[model samples]
Target: MMKLREIAHSRTGDKGNISNISVIAYKQEDYETIKKSVTPEKVKAYFSGIVKGRIIVYQLPNLWALNIVMYEALGGGVTRSLSLDTHGKSLSSLLMDMEIEEEENEAN
Candidate 1:
């Protein structure tokens, strides 16, 4: 087993009360592993405490990435939130902590 960070890197962005997290695999071959492990349901459950709305996962096969959009995630819009990480920039790192089963087929 290994953290998702081992195979991928992420970026986070926010608009209104929503957050978008992009997970891009380091190698094209790892895209399948990411797709299998990082689902909308899983992400929503992972951020259940912080996010109050739905999670959407979009596949970007061309870039070997997944774009996860979380709605109503921020306490409020960035300007109105009291949380230290209002913009959710660090959310990616938080997500990178997610554990995934490493398969023999996974790219190095």
Candidate 2:
């Protein structure tokens, strides 16, 4: 197994109670592995404790990235939330910690 960070990097953004995260592959060839391994269900489950609503994933093959939209994930938006990470900027870092199967070539 390999961590998502091994092949990709992520960026985070927010609006109201929603969190938008984009996972971009470091190499175009690895995009397929990321797409197959990182599903909306998996992302939802990963942040199950924090996100209270539905999740949506949009594929951008040309960009080699996945855009994940998480609803009700900011604990009621930045100004209203009591959490330190109300903006959820650190979410990208947290997501990179998720484990996934390594690419076939990397297993050798």
Candidate 3:
């Protein structure tokens, strides 16, 4: 799971659901490394059951940063399929709290 540490938080226009979140490094000097940590597969695992949309990422030029946009992930596409759960927290923050589990598989 990805560790989602909250940086900035903003709610969508409806204010009923949907949110815009930005996250930075939880640990010092790990910005670049951390940014690289957020892979699509990791997002799947970190979000687990609550997520249901396309995740997009944009890398900032000349900076150790990545901007992620999770589309249609809020309220399960606004069709009553997604519940306003998650405890009213930024998804990025939620992701900040997760740590990717590393394995000991050796390279050939």
lDDT of 2 by residue, 1-108 (tens): 989999999999999999999999999999999999899899999999999999999999999999999999999999999999889999999999999987677557
What's model 2's lDDT at 20?
A: 97
The residue pairs found clashing in candidate 1 are none
Alpha carbon lDDT at 49, candidate 2:
92
TM-score of 2: 0.94
Candidate 1 weakest ten by summed lDDT: 99-108
Q: What shift in Å separates residue 71 of candidate 2 from its native position after superposition?
A: 0.2
Number of clashes found in candidate 2? 0
* lDDT (10s digit) by residue, model 1, range 1-108: 899999999999999999999999999989999999999989988898999988989999999999999998988979998889989889999999999988684355
Task: Estimate every model's Cα lDDT from 0 to 1.
Answer: 0.94, 0.94, 0.50
Instruction: Tell me, by lDDT, which candidate is best.
Output: 2
Residue by residue across 1-108, what tens digits does model 3's lDDT show? Answer: 323343222222222234344444544454555566666667666665655666666665444455666655566444454455532354554665666433233573
Instruction: List CA RMSD, all candidates.
Output: 2.2, 1.8, 6.3
Regions more than 4 Å wrong, model 3? 1-20, 26-28, 61-63, 76-82, 85-89, 101-108
Ranking by TM-score: 2, 1, 3
